[model samples]
Target: MTNLPKIGKPATNALNTINITTLEQVAQLDEHNLAKLHGMGPKAIGILKEALLEQGLSFSQLDEDLKNVKFTVLGDLKCDNAPKRRIIRDIVIASIVGDEKCLTEWLTDDLV
Candidate 1:
């Protein structure tokens, strides 16, 4: 399990009690569910949200929303949006090289 952000003992204990020791695990829960955890306050939640974003991750609902967006690779392999283009390029490279682990981490099973 990866170390979570320093959200204080009470909030950390609240996450630990539910076996959420990794930011990936934290990403699985929506804000509503996280807010329901005893000892998890809004400040702690804000900290966790920032931590998750630093890793290019977000709550499950956001991931679900992203999955709804269709992706395509153009013939020229060029894009005006640097970040989105980089993401697309990375996925394409990962697919071409058969980087299953990278693909699995970035995509849902259905998308994979």
Candidate 2:
């Protein structure tokens, strides 16, 4: 089931144009960007806001530098152990904060 709220057809189409079909995806976009969409008027934005709040989620607070950042793993994950899980989580947090050193710390000689 889709988590996207019942915003009007025009507003829904606007979000779909950018591939935002889920509430989680919507949460990743800020108000400024959403407002810029042709069909996203104030009423639609408000409805989305309320829907998100009901689900205990809100739009991203991304600043200019962090707004378009993308993170990906090119290969299959090698392990599902706790330590590796923590390392992966740390790397994501470090990347968001621009901590290059923390990102590099996980890439030691033993890493496979």
Candidate 3:
């Protein structure tokens, strides 16, 4: 699971029960189904979401939201008040590349 943070024993057992021991499985998980699992809770789901997001993964329900904001940061980077030109240039290049994995992680980037 790539060392998930704040995954308690209870959540661990619950995930294990459902054969979800890896981050990949969790990435494909629907939030609703996860919430229905025994021992799962809002906090556990939040932790799972954070963990998935770290790998550029998200619940299927967030697909629209994620796509809607894909270019938002790119727009911000073009603004006059944007950060360093080099960083912006790299991001723009990455965007032009149009790689889904790259964009997913970079579009929502924060200070590294």
Candidate 4:
């Protein structure tokens, strides 16, 4: 399994303050609900989004990557504010390119 990003104190505190702790909970929140939290500003939301991306996860795309299977970020090609779509595209490209093994190695490398 991929290592989940460390939820920093600020983010954790913000989540606790808003009573959101699990991935499922994060997945359930809409932008409006997230914006309602005390310390979860736009920047914090972006950080959380990045964390999810690093784990090959997103609120809407979580179902695509099953826990029983392994996956990795072969590439992250997207402009700003479109991480979810970028992930989806990259995953599709990975499948088509048949580079899952290389992706797994790259992801396992600490340099990546």
Candidate 5:
């Protein structure tokens, strides 16, 4: 969501804490749940909804057979284990693709 023009660091950090770490994830969340996240305020929610609308989408459209979106990771973490690499790869792909259920199934630790 950092790409969203009006969202500030606080709101971005808040969403990140809950593992809502992708723009696709933001679009999949209901406004009610989005409001409940500690750092999400009314203004942020409005900004998010408007951003989603600009994509020709809304929160409700996450289930519309959307494919996994491709993105490049820009960090120094190295994964030598093939299995772990694949798992991380799949989850990242799912996050990009707006696979809420897949993300939920795999990354449930520390979720609120």
Candidate 6:
């Protein structure tokens, strides 16, 4: 992702006055504190908020109540002792032919 433009002197002074620096700091500012800063009225604050959302990272503390994640593979029968060299050769052929079904079936089988 692209970096945010450096906050200019005016913006920096405004942020420092309100005790904000990083995007995380800006994310935590409430409207009341934001409004008090020079050159940081509603429109500027809205722009900053939009930039944060675009980056897909948030400054909010994560919830401890969130569940742990686990991963599992599903759907296939498999040979217990398949030959890796043969499988690799089949995959190459299937890929060259653009054989989706063959490729999927081969991949879904457990790799030996």
Candidate 2's clash total is 0
Question: What are the runs in model 2 whose C-alpha is more than 4 Å off?
Answer: 64-112
Which residue runs does candidate 6 get wrong by more than 4 Å? 1-8, 57-112
Model 5 segments beyond 4 Å from truth? 61-112
lDDT of 3 by residue, 24-99 (tens): 7777666765776778889989988988898888865734434433342212233466456755666666665666
TM-score of 5: 0.48
Q: Write the per-residue lDDT of candidate 6 for residues 1-112, one digit (tens) a residue.
A: 3444355567667776545556765655554445556676566666666777877644344234321212111111243365775676667657755789979988875855
TM-score head-to-head 3 vs 6, winner: 3
Candidate 5 residue-wise lDDT, 2-101, digit = tens: 3554677888877777666666777666565566666778888788888887876577443334323232332223545687677787788787677999
Supply the TM-score for candidate 4.
0.39
List TM-score per model, in order.
Answer: 0.53, 0.55, 0.50, 0.39, 0.48, 0.38
lDDT of 3 at 5: 63
Candidate 6, residue 37: Cα displacement in angstroms equals 1.4
From the highest lDDT down, the ranking of the candidates is 2, 1, 3, 5, 4, 6
Question: CA lDDT of 48 in candidate 2?
Answer: 92
Top candidate by lDDT:
2
* Candidate 1 local lDDT, 4-98, one digit each (tens): 99998889998887777899989877776677678999999999999999988887673453333344222234445687667667778687657
Sorted by TM-score, highest first, which candidate order results? 2, 1, 3, 5, 4, 6
- In angstroms, the error of model 4 at 87 is 41
TM-score attained by model 1: 0.53
lDDT to native, each model: 0.75, 0.77, 0.68, 0.57, 0.66, 0.56
lDDT of 2 at 35: 80
Instruction: Indicate whether candidate 3 or candidate 4 has the larger TM-score.
Output: 3
TM-score (C-alpha, index-matched) for candidate 6: 0.38
